[model samples]
Target: MINSIIKLAFGIEYDGTHYCGWQRQREANSVQEELERAIAKVANHVIDVVCAGRTDAGVHAIGQVIHFETKSERKDISWIRGVNSYLPADIVVRWVKVMPNAFHARFSAVSRSYRYIIYNHPYHRPAIFSSGMTYYDDFLDIDKMQRSAKCLLGENDFTSFRSSQCQSKSPKRYMMDLTVTRHGLYVIIDIQANSFVHRMVRNIVGSLIEVGCGHQPENWIGNILLRKDRQLAAGTAYAQGLYLMLVRYPLHYEVPQSSIEDFFLIPLLS
Candidate 1:
């Protein structure tokens, strides 16, 4: 007799400071590697997980989603505590649920959201959460950055903002929303999209910083989008400040959304 297959979805949170990235690597450590190992231990067999989105090295996530199939049946609490027991302190399984076969961690998603946090103080760099966020000493014009970011909304080819190493078949993505907000010394860039090419958010943030610092005019972003040339954009921003904040699935899936308040950095801005 064949055993029944069970599909499990997980909400993962991790600090990517010491890992190469989300994907497993041959040589370097990765969040995926650690997570798969932990989950396998609980399943009593090897299992692979598919994530909602892949994040780069030194990046972070508050609401990463993943799905895996297992024959071993266990309570939800068992999966969470068991897998977490084998995982490192920086990575944890926030929640787990039995998912329908039709639900896919990557494909079933409606949209994804990301937040980039910047420390804008000129005199001193934060020592406590130094590796968790980007430190930009230059004074930034919030109004200019806000105005420049508006051009990125809607569907468009983002070749100017994508990394050369990006392997996506197309450069076009539907930008659902993009906003720049400041709270005291913290500058936050929140963006939601149907999908993203590799390093697209960081590259856009770099260009916006140029506008915020008066190095690039407010219209430069629009011009670069028209040019569709990577050379016309600024260098990519640091990976530490970027977070995969949320992933939205259809209402029927009942996937839980991650809270931004769970992150330690949120209190500083609040």
Candidate 2:
């Protein structure tokens, strides 16, 4: 007889510095492997999870969403606490909910958001070392970065900003929003899009830095988009500064809103 299957969705937060990203890798440690191992101990069987986005190595996430099918007979809280008890200190399962069989972690997502944090300061702070914040000594002009960001606010071909190893079928994506702001010595770049090509956010931020530093004109971003040549854009930014902030879904899923707001670089807490 086929076991009764249940689909569960979980919100996870992790520091990606210690692992080789969210996807399972054969050669090195990965966040996926650790999560799967913990989940399997609770399920008493193999458990496979599909994430909303496969974040790259050293890229962190505060609102990562994932789903898995299981036949385990356990309470919802058991899945949360039991899994957490087995997981490493750097990774935690924030929330858990039963999802409809039709729901999916990746395909059901309507949009995904990311935040890039740059510590634009002359001296490095030991407190924030290797904590997913990129350090840059140059002063960044927030006004210029904001002006250049407007050119990417709608659906467009992002070939120039995509990674050479991108596996997406098309280069077109709809950018819902892009904002550049400063918090003390940090430069925060928050972006939301229907989807993204591999390393798209980092690539755009790298070029924006050039504009903010006055090395490139404010309109240079638009020109790069028009050219559709990856070679013409700025180099990809460091992965440590990137955080998969949120993944939006339709209301039917009822995913919880317990996002880790403290981790974001924007809006200093009052």
Candidate of highest lDDT = 1
RMSD to native, candidate 1: 1.1
lDDT of 1 by residue, 1-270 (tens): 777999999999999999999999999999999999999999999989999999999999999999999999999999999999999999999999999999999999989999999999989998978888899999989899989888899999999999999999999999999888888999988899999999999999999999999999999999999999999999999999999999999999999885666667667677
**Model 2 lDDT tens row, 125-161:** 4265557788887889999999988989899999999
- Overall local distance difference test of candidate 2: 0.90
All candidates' TM-scores? 0.97, 0.95
Q: Rate the local accuracy (lDDT) of all candidates.
A: 0.93, 0.90
Worst 10 residues of 2 by lDDT: 261-270
Q: Stretches of candidate 1 above 4 Å error? A: none
